[model samples]
Target chain A: MTRFGRMWVMTGLLLGLAMPAGPARAQEHAPAAAAQAGGHEIDIQHHIGDSHEIEIPFVGIYELPRFAPIHVGGLVIDLSPTKHLVFMLLSALIVALVFVLSARSIAGAQARGRPATGFAGAMEATTLWIRQEVILPTIGPHGDKFVPYLLTLFFFILAMNLFGLVPGGATATGNITVTAALAIIAFLVIEVTGMRTLGPKGYLGTIFYRPHGLPGGPGGAVLKVVLLAVLTPIELIGKLAKPFALAVRLFANMTSGHVLVLALIGLTFLFQSYTVGLGASVLATGVLLLELFVAFLQAYVFTLLTSVFIGLMREAH
Target chain B: MVHALMLALQEEHTSGPLTVEGGLMLWTVFIFILLLLVLKRFAWPAILGAVEAREQALEQQLAEAERSRTEAAALLAEHKRLVADAKGQAHGIIVDARQLAEKERAAAMEKTKQEQQEFLARARREIDVERDRAIADLRREAVDLSLAAASKLIGERVGTDTDRKLVMDYLATLDGGR
Candidate 1:
């Protein structure tokens, strides 16, 4: 094998060997926690879902701080931080710090008539790629104005998704609530752009589509009514469906990868065999690698789909 | 493996993965908006501006390079033209000098030939005049000696103008008869 191939195999082997250790450690306290919860069954939900507790491998699980529920007129809002919420916050903070610093370095270098080097260079390249290749092309002309928003989404989601792969880390992007919020924002941007680009009368055409070259007078009127009656609801559904797809696609993809990895890791404990543990570890390693890819992929997909939706809205006839 | 995955997926849950926590959603919206605003203000403009400035600088540099290359080429062409002109002028100067030298040589040769001819003609004229004078002197002496010899033979004085004229006439007749 070539050097890179050999190195790759070595990494896979190491990852495989290291995979079972975390689950094994957690398994030490699994029975006690399961018993306390009134069951002795494995709860995959505890791994993928939000929790009041945060687990860090090699260190014990710690309960997050709880805040009092805020009362509105008839609604109670619990702003208490959960495991996913904490990870989300961490992802946001990390993105902010890294980008702010990278930007400073880039600007400093540029002022001296040079391109940024090192970590800032890498960050610049990535941001430029997303801006030039993904956002600019997908969202068409005048798309540069939206680069900051889309770039933030991509990096933030990417960080959240990648955090899941870390030992004892949570996947905040896997939560439907988070994905839904992102999708809602994307939907607002798309519709608002459509309204701004097309104005009131033109914007209405997207939902109440009327085909050209229809008969004049009464027949055209009847045809227009018929078209509106049939296609308007479909068009409205399509508009809602775009954001819905964006939300569900990201949530499911991010969640499924973790679920598979969790299930594979669970296999070792279920069988209680060293041979099985090794096999399960190898499998989990493969799934973990795939999860890593999915992390980047889902981020890219979310950004790409949002841009595409915006483009569609911008030019809607 | 599929059965295992299905069994795992079928496992019971307290709160399903699909459930959207309202507070979490609120937090996500707040965080996403905040991040967008922060990054937009601090990061995106600076990074993008820097990149664009760099691109413009590179483009300007490339254009300048092209202009410099064109200028160099033009300068090279002009230098070649000047060298060619200088070479042509030098050749013209050399050709003119040779032609002038040939004309001077021809003129000098003609002058020398004329001077030699004039000297020979003058010498010939002087020789002819000298010969004529000498002949006249010899004739006069011969006539005087003849006169003296005749007087001795006759035993009479014949040295006079009249005698000379008669003798000269006789001599002329005698010469005519011969």
Candidate 2:
């Protein structure tokens, strides 16, 4: 994974800086001139939104192949890969390459009685710290088995988030569609792991009884059953709400940062001056850095919350 | 047609950022699962195994070092005890030898002192006997000379027992009177 991660990162960064006057150049005149900007509002929308073409305003805009009209037994399904989808593929490839490569280094270093140095060592430290400190502590010792799943989520989201900060790359997490899919996976894991660990009855017991068991005597059992039935809908809502929050939190955080940066850039044309453009770039720089921080922070929060949910389900109560 | 165009433009402007296309979500799921499978199969096991193996090796090395140190300490204590024991034994033997030497010297001195006393007594007895013999010889010679002088004065050869007796008796009486 490290190999692909390095390749993608280098490519992304180089394409970003070297392409000067590229996407950033797309905000020309008043941004209201080309795609119908609403005093910078429309421009901000277009900038963050997914597009069917790779647009580098100064050089070219290449329209992607459209497959929305494909017919399969009279049922048409659109399966074309958009800009975000391409980056999404790159993100996956990056994740696969980084982990696979680093795993090889770690395995090899074991023979020499040490760890891999430089980049590989840093990667190893992160993996270990997250597994031991974040996942295992929350999920318990048995949580060791789930380390790969949790780690993959972290690095994948992290890669995509950071990639979005690069000049031309679309932040996949900024799209609600992408964030919703990730949240669905988390929800499945939480519910499925709960079922598997607690065994169907024990799983329902979480929504009903307090982990120990149901009440003892007849009157008490009746009272408890009444409480469980009364609160079951609320418990069900709580279960669904956790993943929803996870998805929205990330989607909002990433989308807001990009919107802010685009707005700062759009301010240049709003005032119609080169000096304003320079000043706006300076201000945008600060927000750009904040977006970078948010990228890492949001990824961490998503992974941590997912782990916490899994832990709550796995452990006794 | 112009109103339709106007509506299309309005929709285009609003449709981009917030739209959650079903197709993109499906694509994302497919991509994420592909990543998960690839990582799980190709990467995770090796990395986790290497980490555990390294930990075990480090722990084993530390334990071996501790054992060796303990054994070395025990051997050092044993060596020190042996050296102390040998020194004490040697000192005891030296003291015993010195005491034996002192006793032998004192016995030899006592024997030599008794032999010297006996020799002195014997020498004193022999010296007294020699002195007595010398005095007797001198007296006899004096008696003989006195007898010869009397005979010459009388111009006669006298050999009688009575005459000899008288001479002896006269000498004895003269000595008693003096």
Candidate 3:
């Protein structure tokens, strides 16, 4: 922020601090304080963290019904519904519904010999762009086969990310586990396709490939084998690191935006002045909107990297 | 899920944002799998098929349109060629007709000129014949008169055949010389 903006914020916060309310502040700030003793850090975590109950700001908290009531030696499976799970499921259903409706209309258009319209047209444009520009360019020659998977990944992640910005929603992608699972799926697809294309021996050789031409001798053969041994782990790590970075990049981006938004809101509570809170909220709105853009950008990045990884794995050179 | 960690967990160890609980992970994976299965089975095939079909249709339509254009151009060129051929034939026919008429006209004029020369020669022949006949008659009369006059002058009549023949012969010689 500029100096003028900062002064304005501080003035608002000072005015907010002049207000008086004891019990509500103490009660609200209690859970927040458990994370960070004093400061805006506590509320930020409370906002993004997964919880047993769905907390709606205007509406009261609604506790999820628990499943698997039996406890196995005081260590339950903990396989009950969560706020994250609800929102995640909701996001999935929404994505499915949108695509299903669009697909049906498109299919109908094809049947009747008419042009695609409205949402179907939009979906068509996006699908075609991904096929031609994103997937085809990256995977090369017959890269079109990967379109379904990439489309699923792109739209799925995009929907989930946008869902997080809802009034009473949690970011499913913000969770490490979610990002990790997605990355794991992408990794499996990459490896399987690589193995399918290159064959087992070629795939293994690619992992340990040495560019230098080996001299014709027993000693040179031994040296080449040794060099391969030395370089194999590095190559393997490099392969694994692509997916790892993909997961972290998405998780960090999604989580950071929520954190920023929360912290800004928490600034109002920190000052205990409604005027300062208002000013902070006004400021946070900009970032909140930016989060929407970041959500899309991060989803594109994840899908793009996955494409690049798949491309890298499929091509021997 | 109602994990005891939320309300009564330690702030220090649990403070890290990267920590993963088993429950959330399981749910996420399960939900994702369910989503993939549902989409792959129901949604993807339909959408991808439609888009592919539409694209192919468009390509086929475009190709057909191009073929039609080429056929039209060829037909136009053929029509133009036939028109040009007909025009050339008509021009040739006109030239032949004019040449034939010119030949007939020249033949008729030559025949008329020959007939005029023949008629003039015939008239000259008839005139020459008539003039010769008149001269013969005049010579006869002159011979008879000359004989009569001579007899009168001599106060004698020459009744001998030889005398008449001699005078006639002398007249014939004068006529031939003239």
Query: For residues A211-283, what per-residue lDDT tens digits would candidate 1 score against the true structure?
Result: 8788899988998899889989999999999999999999999988877766665555466455775686677
User: Candidate 3's residue-wise lDDT over A1-317, tens digit each?
Assistant: 24533544455344334422111222233343534554323344555667677765435678998776446586545677777778888988998888888878888887898767998889877877776778878887887778778888888888889878765567888878788888888888998998999999978876887768788699988988888888888888988998899999999999887766555655555565668656765666667678889988998888888888888888865
Q: Which docking class does model 1 fall in?
A: acceptable
- lDDT sort, best first: 1, 2, 3
Q: Where's the lowest-lDDT run of ten residues in candidate 1 chain A?
A: A20-29
TM-score of chain B of each: 0.65, 0.52, 0.67
Global lDDT of each model? 0.81, 0.74, 0.73
Instruction: State the lDDT of candidate 2 residue by residue for A1-317, as single tens digits.
Output: 34532442443344346433122532432233433533333245555678887654345667889785456576554678788888888888987888899888887787687878877777888888888888888887688878888988999999888777655577888888889999999999999999999998888877765434666899777877787777777788889999999989998998887766666655544555567766766666677777778888998899899999998888745
**Candidate 3: Cα lDDT at A137:** 89
Task: Give me the runs in candidate 2 sitting further than 4 Å from their true place.
Answer: A1-35, A38-42, A69-77, A104-115, A210-219, A273-279, B1-19, B90-178
- The candidates, ranked best first by TM-score, are 3, 1, 2
In order, the candidates keep a fraction of the true contacts of 0.73, 0.65, 0.43
lDDT of 1 by residue, B1-115 (tens): 3554454357675346787777888999999999999999999999889889888889999999999999999999999999999999999999999999999999999999999
* Clashing pairs counted in every model: 0, 5, 4
User: Native-vs-model 3 lDDT?
Assistant: 0.73
Task: Return the top candidate by DockQ.
Answer: 1
The interface RMSD values of the models, given in order, are 2.2, 5.1, 5.3
Q: Rank the candidate models, highest DockQ first.
A: 1, 2, 3
